[model samples]
Target: MTLRDEITNCRICAERFAATKTRHQPRPVPWFTPTARVLIAGQAPGLRVHRSGKPFTDASGDRLRDWLGMPPEVFYDLSRVAIVPMAFCFPGYNAQGYDLPPPKVCGQTWHDRVMAELPQVRLRVLVGGAAHRYHLGTKAGVTETVQNWRAYAPDTFVLPHPSWRNTGWLTKNPWFGEEVLPALKARVKEVLND
Candidate 1:
């Protein structure tokens, strides 16, 4: 069987969120894109995204939109940028008001295939340890600290999760504001214009 099909039958994640989630195809995301210049690697979707069937449709998405210096119209356009998280669905909630970690099966089964279709990706924003762990294992540190961004590849900037919970981190990491944002914007403009 094709690897993509095997990913659709993922019982590990299905045991939780999928049981209660609205019915649809087994693998819910778009899965691939060709016009994408930048890829945003986040954790799993929250309930909002699962319901909307659009990744990053919540407060976190608002932060990401701001970070990209783009509006909702542009940001949602899959032809421009791609949002492929470590997990695809709403993994349900935990006590901290945060969603659970994305299922390992999703990443282990699907990411490389999807990435294979996105050869033009000039940048990939690895947001959390889940993404950082897989995409930049040896290249970037595994501790989920935003400070280890430089250890990853060029055009790929690792970021702390953009949830409002990270407000304090953003405040503490002024270099992320002073250095990374400008560089990010510059690269974003170059990609969009190309």
Candidate 2:
């Protein structure tokens, strides 16, 4: 079986999910292809993604496409883009109603194995804090890491989660829109085109 299929059919994650206090079933949602040049590495799937079994099928995805200056057809094209989160399954909600952080076990178990299949990836867009930490190691806080984006240029771009929960952060960080988005879109276009 292909590495991609093995990851998609992972029952280890299902067992992990079942053992969670919430006991929700896991539905791994990721897309990978040998030709993909851009990898959208974000946090875990949300309830919406779990229900649909499709990655980035929500408003955050709409905003992410906007950030990349790509329409849905292009952004969702598996041949050009890979969507792999820190955790593949929905990690369930906390008592406060926010989704819980993605389990570290999921990344520990699968990220390296799955990432090994995408040797063509040129741009790794690390969305949210968890992904940044996992890929870039212990760095400054998200804001600082993202503000220092040039340090990881050409190959990696740090971004806050595109969820509406971070809308206030976007408003507060105007430079993200004015300075970062244009450069991000350009790099994304270049990688996908190449």
Candidate 3:
């Protein structure tokens, strides 16, 4: 079977949170097309995405689209953009209402196989610290990685999560909006046009 087929049918880590079964389900939400040039490598699906079976369908998604300077039609078109999170499923929330980190098993089990199917991904947008860690390794923390965007130019762009939780970070980092954003949008358009 193709990697997509295998991923869609996977239940390998379903039992990771058997105790939290009452709160969440293992619905692997991933979007991709083998020919997609731009890949949005984000964290796991949030509660909304897991419920909707769409990778990004909440306020965070709206903000992400804004950052990319793309309309929903173009952003959601898997033929051009691939949305593959570090974890395929929602990893459930904690008592404080924040989502738990995606289980390591998800990456260990599926990333390589799924990535193999996406040979055409030219510009990978790492959408959060976790994604940066996985794709860019321990080269730098999120702040440093994102600050040094030029190092990964044309091939990757590291970004903070677009969730409301990071509103303060965005406010503090004016350069992200002024310098990084324009470059990000241009790179995205360039890759898609390729």
Candidate 4:
């Protein structure tokens, strides 16, 4: 079986997820192909994506697509883009109803292997702190890391999570829109067209 198959069949997080408020089963939404040139390294699936079995199907996804300057048709095309998260399933909600962080074991078990399958990836868009930590090995906070986007641009772009919760963050970080995004969009277009 392919690496994708192995991940889809994984039940390692079954018991742990059952303990969450959602008490959901493991539904790995591994969306990628070997031919993809752009890798979207996101945090994890949210409840909507978990239910739909598609990555980036929520409001956050809409924001992400806008960030990329991509439409759904282009964003969802497996031949050109690979959507690999730090975790594959929704980690569920905490006591306060905020999303729980992705289970670390998911990355430990599958990330390297999944990356190996996508050898053609020319651009990596790391969304959120978890993805930034995993892909860029940075100890910096999201704001700092994203502020230094030029350090990794044209190849990788580290972004804060595009969730509605970060609306305040977006307002505070106007440079993200005025500076990083134009360069990012150009890079994304260049890479995808290449």
Q: For every candidate structure, what is the RMSD over all alpha carbons to the true structure, in angstroms? A: 3.7, 1.5, 1.4, 0.7
TM-score for each predicted model, relative to the true structure: 0.82, 0.94, 0.94, 0.98
**What TM-score quantifies how close candidate 4 is to the native fold?**
0.98
lDDT of each: 0.72, 0.87, 0.86, 0.94
Query: Tens-digit lDDT track for model 3 on 62-95?
Result: 9999999889999999898899898998888776
User: Where does candidate 2 stray beyond 4 Å?
Assistant: 19-22
Winning candidate number (TM-score): 4
Write candidate 1's Cα lDDT for 60-114 as tens digits. 9898878878888878787878888888656666655556677787777678887
The residue pairs in collision within model 1 are none
- Model 2, residue pairs in steric clash: none
Please report the candidate that would top lDDT against the real structure.
Answer: 4
Q: What lDDT tens digits, residue by residue, belong to model 2 across residues 55-108? A: 888999899889989898988889989999999989987656668889888899
lDDT: which is higher, 1 or 2? 2
Cα deviation at 116, candidate 1, in Å, is 0.8
Q: How accurate is candidate 1 locally (lDDT)?
A: 0.72
Q: What is the lDDT of residue 194 in candidate 2?
A: 70
> Residue 119 in model 3: shift from native, Å?
1.4
Error of 3 at 21 (Å): 7.9
